[model samples]
Target: MAENSLEKDYLEEDTQHGRYLTFSLEEEVFGIEIKYVTEIIGMQSITKVPEVPPHIKGIINLRGKIIPVIDVRLQFGKEPVDYNDRTCIIVIDIDAVSVGLIVDNVEEVLNIDDEAISPPPSNKTGFENRFMKGIGKAGGKVQLLLDCERLLKSDEMEIVEELFEEK
Candidate 1:
């Protein structure tokens, strides 16, 4: 549960302020800006697609929308674990395209002040650091703030798009 703090304490920028939907990945808390979150759905049957990365769990037809789901654990390079009742997808709009993020469990939406967020560590040499928008501190808890736009890069986005298009 002790996730590494991304950066040193810096001046809080007001632009980061807003409601964030926090979720659990194991014990670590992660937050995605609520502006991009569409809704939360229980883990349903996901039709696996061929030739995509393992992290890309494949697509789901929610009512009618075909949204690709990515295992956040796998995306973070963590060991794969079994999905339980608490497991669900946080459907978010990344640059307008809807995608589902499979999280260990969904917590609640939190109103994180800009002052509570710290910049991502400049010293990190890992890929995960690239996706971090900042580290959020609220209610004495730390939440890894994710940059939704960067969650899936242009090329990765293209890959996800093609997964279902090929069908």
Candidate 2:
């Protein structure tokens, strides 16, 4: 019985450790769970799909698979900037749908404890608040933890579907 209790405690602690793939957008550091990440690719030529939202940069051919790209900065309502050498597209798979998110650069993977994550601020003053799941305190600063699933919700998918149907 004591051994079973110890095992349970270990499992609980293991679950508390959240791994995030950190990245930079503008000057702020942001993170998303590693589980959702597919791959990080350098900036590629995107074939513009017309009439989609401005944030939807377009689609890219990934080894014969066409994946839609969303400019992360633009989606967060930031001013548009030219893609430079440091630009990258982080492919993510959520709910069986694959999409690419354009970021300024890819940072690093970090393991954050549940205790270090705090709920988002009540006042959604900035771009960080709308998509952020929480503020993860690490490495002497807060890493904006993004709720990727929430950020790329079904509404976006429906828009894409409708666009394709029209085309």
lDDT per model, in order?
Answer: 0.88, 0.86
Using all chains and alpha carbons, the TM-scores for the candidates as numbered come to 0.85, 0.83
lDDT of 2 by residue, 1-167 (tens): 99999999998767625989999989999999888899999999999998888998888989987788999999888889999999999999867667899999999989888899999987756544667789998878889999988876577877654544534
Model 1 weakest 10-residue run by lDDT: 2-11
Clashing pairs in 1: 6-121
lDDT of 2 at 37: 91
* Model 2 clashing residue pairs (backbone): none
Q: What CA RMSD would you report for each candidate?
A: 9.6, 4.1
lDDT (Cα, tens digit) per residue for candidate 1, span 23-90: 99988999999878899999999999888889999999999889999999999999999999999899
Question: What shift in Å separates residue 8 of candidate 1 from its native position after superposition?
Answer: 36
